[model samples]
Target: MADFVDREAIRHCLARLARGEDRRDAGLIRAAWWPDATFDYGVYSGDFAAYLDWVVPGAEAISNTQHVLGQSYIELAGDSAKAETHVISYHRVDMGAGDRDTCIGGRYLDTMARRDGEWRIADRVMLYDWYQDWGAAIDWAEGVMGYPFTAGHFPGRARGDFSATFFAAGQ
Candidate 1:
């Protein structure tokens, strides 16, 4: 047992999660967690896989997203450790005729365990202090990411009914 459990390893796990989430790659997302990892969101609670299923797709539907991690707190004991990372997130979504932008700040509390020299998150809980929703802040989402809104004109939009779709098969 060391005072520090290879801090870089913890950082790498966070990086992997952020990358996977940004790319909407489920496989990469899973690689960031332990098999029995548990997640407790404000309203969602279950394995990491289920949490990703709901959150990731919705993120993909958004225009732009940036998950930035700030300061961190980590403590190691034996083969297990605890970590907390401050986060600032920016997101933009289509609002039919236009679009909406949001900025949220939160912290991720994670329990890490090293098994066979691999670090994985065994449990994670999100602590969101507050969020500022800048409704439709950008006229064009700041970049051309093919936002569902703003077709050829402000009024012209793609006719696609929105519904909840989850990859239940874990594809």
Candidate 2:
């Protein structure tokens, strides 16, 4: 049905937004929002452009990051919809002494609108559920603490890392 299609499109848009952050791709992140879209993330409240400006560089500086999606509840009306998506974001920051792990659980409450048959977020409010942080010491040269003999086959999170190449080839 048309409603099912709309819901899937909305889900795809949200997933792309998360992928953009994980890959540190500004363009992909920008595509998820309309030019005048608004966002409130507790720590920052601003327009989509401002949100991208603030988030891009900050995400790029992190050693590694992942946004794990839990569940999404969407209510659809003719050309408008409201959605709440649960997320758990994990970040590893490398300091001089050691790496630190930061984990946050939150919900993205979004107002979406279809313009020219394309759906994008019109406004988003992020609600925090919980958060935690701890020091994560590891020997990257040999892998994690107990897995000393493991091999690092996966690529880094940087733009041109091997993962990108692998994904491109698969596509």
Q: Which prediction has the highest TM-score against the true structure?
A: 2
Model 2, position 97, has a per-residue lDDT of 56
Q: Which stretches of candidate 1 lie over 4 Å from their true place?
A: 1-5, 59-61, 95-97, 137-171
lDDT measured at residue 154 in model 2 versus the true structure, 0 to 100: 38
lDDT of 2 by residue, 40-79 (tens): 9988999988988877777433777889887889999989
Poorest lDDT segment (10 consecutive residues) of candidate 2: 151-160
**TM value for model 2:** 0.87
* Deviation of model 2 at 147, angstroms: 3.2
Candidate 1 backbone clash number: 1
What is the number of backbone collisions in each predicted candidate, taken in the order shown? 1, 0
Mark the regions of model 2 whose C-alpha exceeds 4 Å error after superposition.
Answer: 59-61, 94-97, 148-161
Tens digit per residue, CA lDDT, model 1, 1-171: 345447888888998887676656677788889978999978788987687776677544476666889988898877888999999987777656566778889999999999998888999999998798788644543335555454433321222212112234455
